[model samples]
Target: MPRPDRPTRPSARSGVAPFHVMEVLAAAKARQRARGDALLLCTGQPATPAPRRVRAAAAAAAAEEVLGYTEAAGDPALRAAIAAWHRGRYGTAVTAGQVVVTTGVSGALILVFLAALDPGDEVVLARPGYPAYRNTLAALGAEVVELDCGPDTRHQLTAEMLAALPRPPRAVIVTSPDNPTGTIIDEAELARIARWCAAHGTLLVSDEIYHGIDYGRRCASALESSAAAVVAGGFSKYFSMTGWRLGWLILPEELVGPVTRLAANLTVCPPAVSQAAAAQALHPESLAELDGHVRRYRDNRDLLLEGLAAAGIDRVAPADGAFYLWADVSDYTDDSLVWCAELLDRTGVALAPGVDFDAVHGGGRVRLCYAGAPGDLAEACRRLSRVTGRA
Candidate 1:
């Protein structure tokens, strides 16, 4: 407590970067309401609804019984379902006791960071990766060391990179079907990195939130390689349950008690209704419906890729999975934030600036999301052609 004579000040921990995509999104919303012509390509997350069965379960849980707080870790049935899901999908020997549900991947990361990282402990991140991970870790007082990943490695970190470091950092994060760039890591490479982390005693935080939305390449879970990896995933992106606010973590046996205790104190529990209904998301009926959404995402990705090419934006990351296309707009402008603003104002096209993700090379890059209506993506491309003068 500060003395009465002195004013209290904000801690240094709060000094973190903002998600500029959210800012662009807010402005896009305002433009949409005012002009009804905004083509929002900046947003992440699938533009779809929860699975039919999952929604039905939510409705049933709300009407059939009292919706109350669940166990801090989560509903036993849901935990078992997730554990089984992981086991079946990745052939990992996961168990219900190791699954700790949280509000979202956001919450799970917070819990794991608190449990695993101490202030000044170094954590490795791929450059131009998800901003939230870097921001959250920074705010938690972790030393973030970003690896300058480019098209050479599909904007991902490799085992060779880690071995070359002065020493193994406290932890390293790997995101497949990564946000912003949307590149999926190679399975063989992922296994090698996992083994390296285990051998070197560095914690590996594998973020697999965008699984099940791949194109030609398949996404691999770190659990398939090493049991020591802390895996965080959510129903948001692939399941189209962003609002349901349900996510989970698969922890090592040693981490279960600590993460659960921290979650119990910090969140009390994830939304009870979500826990009750989310298990249904794993059902066969719901999965069939969800698979249709993935097909549409693929179509959208192709359309966007073709359109960007027509607009003379040739440089791009390999978008093997996820619904994003990372494009180099250096020909049009050196400042992505300004370029995005001008495009929004002139043609009502909202795009995520690269500067939000990479402080080094983001100025001339932009990320466009193709998860929305196909018509909107096409029209946004047409409008963009006028600005780029490539048509």
Candidate 2:
């Protein structure tokens, strides 16, 4: 068998970093299959099922319509629904012509990278961001320039940092309710960053996947800052429709056609059933159901924070939103990967190592998902206390 690192026909793209959370999740699942007691706190997947209206919509589409491919830009009605949804949520003037449906946020990122960047171009993002940003850009031969964003800046990019870069990158990506930290950018600060990018002629790519899951203050969209911003969103996180693989990008007038063209060749069109279901996902009934899931996630987040503190893990990131608790576990072990492996072996509680998010400081950190059931989170806390020898 050919090894991953020594494959016979490996291209440079094959060398992109793997998503460690998914790797850990696969391990956790295997352990559950064998031992039947794994506590999964890795990966940001909601335990809630899709809303009844969305499911009904998908079933109805399957029964009534041909499952054939829609237009490459997605169904016109779905695009209109997404535009209306964005307009209502963020008070932005979005039109259906600006929307292009994608296979997922992952696909949106790839398409954006392909459309906006050339080989050897640079993309700037905050450190400890979603790993896919780095890996995806790297796979496309784009140089990823990471801004070291510690807790002092709420783990978000700042305008000063962008100004200090040796030269402007081709694009700058920002995420609110950020991955690995769950810290949202201040609206004013985000606007400043957007202005800086616009002045510097850098394309602003905003990952708004975690929107609608905020705790207290709702996160701001990049569109509020710049008209040229490229916004990527999906039904995966907030809508609890992970397997649906429905995501979209809101583009400027110039890039819409190019991205749509790229998307046409990429996957032809997103799933017909998923598009039908996602249309209903934006309905009032579905939004209400999703809000209930957010409430449960909020409660679970509170429980996890208290439990971590009680277990002497007090140096956690300030998770203002999202269902993740990025904890500093340096007191327990230096290498988070090894620590996570031991934790799974001893306690059957799986978590994503910090290294997946940050290559330099990640060895001392881990990301725990609080998107599971409340009972499971409580049990995870108990198992963590036992494993860490908390009194």
Candidate 3:
């Protein structure tokens, strides 16, 4: 039997690209353990803790209620709370039956992909986007069609690009308050893209994970444009609940059942305590507290921008929303990975290389997240200035 081809060890689908920012984060952690001074601007996790009410609610649930699994689609109360939250934010008629809570936005994405895509189906997205979108779809045998988005368009996708694609995709993802680059698609332009997708018979997966963290102008939710879109949202960003493992997807009536069936087989249900606590997370007082965190992010962003310009590294993406500043570091090095590794070594300041976001043209770019305290950001800028010889 020819020795059975040496026991073909791993599945080909398991070879999805590593989310490289995680490697950067691992390095940062190691540097911190050794020197106790590393500054991490690589991940988008907020510096603040979860809201007090959320924490208290989780604790109360632990103390008072059984932590067994709820329904596969998640707790009806939590889903209802999420629907009400959307109705208040975007003036949409969101009903509880349309919501499916998942382990996180990552989990929601997997269910969404499984429900909407078949093998060989194509999904169109911007090139310099969240890497997981490509990796997840590829792992499931879906074709990822990338549109090149650059500075001329402020790193956003337009309806014109969708029309010009070789063929319409099975789905198109729109991330406002985008990852890596904090660019917000204009509300009017978003509506145009929504209409284009509708006309082309394509599913629109709107990732509004960073909804409440805009810099100046308010970002619009896709429900304001297309009620048919599958909206993926989570508590990680604005709610400061990264480790809580709670997120929800708002689907059209047709999709809810399919996605719920997938979730039943995949996750069984989201965490019981998390769904219980998330109900309190939507409280008015909790929201007000979360807004304060956004204010701190804005302050940190301003400081980093000024400091980077003073350090003579001026080429940057428009940080219209989100906590990341996508910076061009071509003046320093052509390869961002090497530059990032060396920068961490020399100054103990870690940032994500842009290759993680844009494999085509991101070797000379970097993304620095401002979801940290002002003091840490200022000290990081000081170290960067000194290390880059701009001091």
Give stretches of model 1 more than 4 Å off. Answer: 1-8
Q: Using alpha carbons, what is the TM-score of model 3?
A: 0.98
Tens-digit lDDT track for model 1 on 166-274? 9999999999989889999989999999999999889999999999989989899999999999999999988999999999999999899999999999989999988
With a 3 Å backbone cut-off (N, CA, C), the pairs that clash in candidate 3 are none
Q: Write the per-residue lDDT of candidate 3 for residues 92-206, one digit (tens) a residue.
A: 9999999999999999999999998999999999879999999999999999999999988779889999999888899999899999899999899999989998888999999
Tens digits of lDDT, candidate 2, 1-391: 7656755777968798777777778889999999999999998888887889998988898999888988999999999999999999889999999999998999899998999899999899898889989988888899999988998999999988988889988899999988989999999998998888889899999999999999997699999989989999998999999999989999999999899899889889999899977888888988999999999889999999998888888898888888899899998988999899888888889999999999989999999999998888888888888867895
For each candidate in turn, give its C-alpha RMSD to the true structure in angstroms. 1.5, 2.7, 1.1
Clashes of 3: 0
Ranking by lDDT: 1, 3, 2
Candidate 2 off by > 4 Å: 1-8
Best by lDDT: 1
In order of listing, the candidates' clash counts read 0, 0, 0
Model 1 residue 255 CA deviation in Å: 0.6
TM per model? 0.98, 0.97, 0.98
lDDT of 1: 0.93
